[model samples]
Target chain A: MLEKAIKGSKLYWGWIGLLLLGVATGFFAYTFQMKEGLSITGMSRDVSWGFYIAQFTFLVGVAASAVMMVIPKYLHHYQTFGRVLILGEFLAVAAVSMCLLFIVVDLGQPQRMLNVLLHPTPRSILFWDMIVLNGYLFLNILIGWVTLQAERKGVEPPKWIKPFIYLSIPWAVSIHTVTAFLYCGLPGRGFWLTAILAPRFLASAFASGPAFLILLCYIVKIFAKWDPGKEAIQSLAKIVTYAIITNLFFLSLEIFTVGYSQIPSHLLHFKYLFFGLEGHATYAPWMWVSVVAGLLAVLILLFPQNRKSDNVLAMACVLVFLSTWIDKGMGMISGGFVPNPLEEVVEYIPTKLELLITLGVYAAGFLILTILYKVAVGVKKEVDA
Target chain B: MRANRRKFLKIAGLATLGWSVFPNLLRASEGGEGAGHVRWGLAIDTKKLNDEVMEKAIVACHKNHNVPHIPDKREIKWLWKTTFHKAFPGQMLDNMHISEYAEKETLVLCNHCDNPPCVRVCPTKATFKRADGITMMDFHRCIGCRYCMAACPFGARSFNFYDPKKFLKSEEITTQFPTRTKGVVEKCLLCYERLDEGKKPYCVEAAEGVIYFGNLNDPESEIRKVLAERYAIKRKPELGTFPSVYYLI
Candidate 1:
């Protein structure tokens, strides 16, 4: 069915061409980083991780959000999701690929990345993260492909596939939880030490991942001329509304704890992110934008009329996507590092090369997403005819 | 079937014995002969540490280790200097007299925690805690993910963002120690190399009376004596890393 990706309209080829160009440029920047080291990036010794890890964190949430569709379709037997569930699984495949790519690009020794497997330490959260992410990527690919093949043939998926599909539901949660453990289990990082971090990650992931999927459904409707169905989209919008609200509620609880306890080590990180810490507020603007956009998204999504309208729902999903992107991608990792353990604020701003490499990874992910979606839609159209 | 069962029981018994005894044998061999008996520690007499004394110690350690002198935030230092308040942020008090202590420059380095978070978070065991309680790094094995840096509460770990050799002059390079490549995390190994050579760490040698280095497990060691007689405090002690380094305030 990959042949379906090859035989697309001029617009599809053009999009594929653009993505290839992005991959080429990112590879070019990466060679420079390899030669000169991580100096080409904006990370200092103070903020050891920058844009690459942040993007990895955000994309992990996106990957994990496939469960939102998986749970409703498999457990609840919601038939509306049957048409769109493959799209969600494919999105997870792409997102997990991006997550892995972001990690590789961020490494100072990308060449030695296999060492994580070779000299695996069971105690390291990163070690578990590697296991869970790869497991998730594999699960999504196997389930999405096998089930879609059965759909194209107009038969129920084989019995063996059922266990795998059910397993993916919890595996999705494990991927994000392990990613959170990569931060929360660390001793001195005051910002990430919260026990609620995994829950918060899941809530934000559910909101952003589904919101992005809703937008993708619209794109499929226009481009592929196959509606994923309005009922499916509306149900997703409701999921986004509840998830985003939960995300905001979790954020408030974190704030209340930090504010009431008044522990300077913990309080300082929030101060740096929300306000200026010692006159350096690099992320403050971005954080406020995330906060305002999240609240506005919730307000827009709350009403029944807004959910019914395609335009309003799209706007709200975009807001939800943007809001979570900034919160997780921009603030979360850097916030933990800044006002660093010693209480010194060293800012991180991604260099052009870093941003280019990041764009390359995103393009790579989209390229995968496009090809997968093309095959799924092509199969759907064939079966419908 | 009876012969096979007898053989399995013998093999299983040997395996259990090897599991228990081999670890002890391996631990004994790890930091050289009798290294399992030593838990190396440092006690810094901050009151005795002036700028000149601190500089000598920092310079000695850097010179011996071939640590580059990068003059920016990207600078690498196995040992360095900072203010008291910065070193111990959790200990700050709201009084003018206490604020004076905040301005006093104090020496800082890797605490080489007994329960190192860096060791716990390292994906590849590239950074590890030795039998002698010193945290060591194997640069060749590091994937440079920098998770150890995030785990270190002291901000002690430094990633080689650039090829470290570039910053060192030909004359400044120490042939005794290998210069690190870019993309690996490094920090004060607490002079494990010197300890192996039966010599004090270069910093201890340079600032003789100010910094005490000894085997903490030995009750009569100088570090233990210093701890007994002085009011020394370990940084972020509440976090339970149980840092091997202590500061005499």
Candidate 2:
């Protein structure tokens, strides 16, 4: 069985084919980015950030979702996540990889990314962001590799792996928290200037992250005949429901505080985001769509009957993920700069080159995640024996 | 006693080393780089800042800088015209709102603040304040973060949504400064480059006698002469961003 698994795995060729296609597309996009600079993407002065940042924000939530599985398996002694643990780790690896790519593509000079570390600015939040992102990426890699190695051996896992697993629980939270701080720490952007942004970020992250995981589990069950358990999905759905509620509650608090105060500066960005203030209605439609989608997603997750349906549950996760992405990533960052201190509305739209680069990065991340998961699945067959 | 003397010497030596390590700390608590150098401040005289002068100054500055006025109203503005009263929304002239001259506006641009908010918010240290109270951006280092835009209450920053240099007149085009790609923000630099050559700012030179061009620090400068003899005011002193541009009414 081990020899056959190594010689001709069912999923291995499919993974390799997809990976090659992704790499080719990514290379083409990268070449375009090099020639044209960042003008290819949509980003303007008033809306300095756009889709890439939104994607980064969304991926952080995905990365943090690893803790959903890790916490249950290790701390609560929930055996339901035993098979699903590798899936969570693989998702984290893909998500973090995407997060880094988004940031690189967003930069004006991608080569100068090293300067953030080499010429470290202790005063800048970006310096801390660099530290946290790289740290989180490495932590996930170490944990995933060690856990998988132990799982394959079928031993109770080494004692050292225990500490790393425990460490990952908090580290997962730290990644999203650090990402939140990146926006909240900025001074005058009224929408992002709240003390509750970190909590809100974590809440939303846990919600969408777990939703994606549950959906992924169901997907693999149908396609690969891998049944982690129905109990795990039900348990994860409950956690996700609560997380979504918290996310919405926090968002409401932000809106209420800003709206009730009637402060012009504080109200400006939100007004620009949700409802058009004057002629600047660019992101207003997207903002409203995200809000409506988010509310609907929560409702769907809240109902057990709807969550039981594989199609509805999967679709809810997809919508929830996208809605959160638009809200946290796109609107949040872009809206922060609108009605800029000078009261001028500078519009930022990402360029075509930027879009290509972004697509390339996504391909790279997906390719990595796919290959890693295939290897894990192949190795799982050996361990089960 | 010998031990005490050695300890005292050691303490003194450390103090000297500390001062040497932070060289700037050795300087007196002067507002600017050079001690006794008067910090420049602006006082706008709303009466003289009419639409004609505003247009003239803006056109001159734009022409000189090759700032493109993309016909799209939203995209237009290098040195645009804005109402003087609206510009200084916080302060009132003689306790009465300056509403009568609402139709006639003033030219507004970057206010080279003594403590600029834009400089404080820059993540990459791209936007910085010079020793002479000039807030400038190093376009090369700018990562298009737009934090400076959010921080600036003045709405002075602009992002290069496309290659802006492409809009330049054929003869006006130069490769001295890389045309900002889409993403990075750019704004008025107060023509610091032109100032280095002992030339008045393009706006001031083009304004003929409408706008004064001289150092505010030197009391003997034309700007100081105008302020000493005439009634002048700044846009928003209440914001605590001490601007270096003044207007004479």
Q: Pick by lDDT: which candidate is best? A: 1
* Each model's backbone clash number: 0, 27
Tens digits of per-residue lDDT, candidate 2, A1-385, equal 1233244445656766676786677678767656655445555444557778878888888888889888888998999888778888888989998998888766666665665555556666666666777777787777777777777777667787778788888888888888787777655456777899889989989888888888778766766556767888878888888888888899999889989997776888888888867798888989888888889988888888998887887888887877777887678777777766545676666666566666677778877776666567667767766
lDDT of 2: 0.73
lDDT of 2 at A197: 89
lDDT of 1 by residue, A1-385 (tens): 7888888999999999999999999999989999999999999999999999999999999999999999999999999999899999999999999999999999999999999979878999999999999999999999999999999989999999999999999999999999999999988888999999999999999999999999999999999899999999999999999999999999999999999999988899999999989899988888999999999999999999989999999999999999999999999988899888889888988899999999999999999999999999999999999
Off by over 4 Å in 1: B1-31, B96-99
Q: Which prediction has the highest DockQ against the true structure?
A: 1
Q: Candidate 2 chain B — worst ten consecutive residues by lDDT sum? A: B30-39
The per-model lDDT (C-alpha) reads: 0.93, 0.73
DockQ of 2: 0.25
Model 1 chain A: ten consecutive residues of lowest lDDT: A1-10
Task: List interface RMSDs for the candidates, in order.
Answer: 0.7, 3.4
lDDT of 1: 0.93
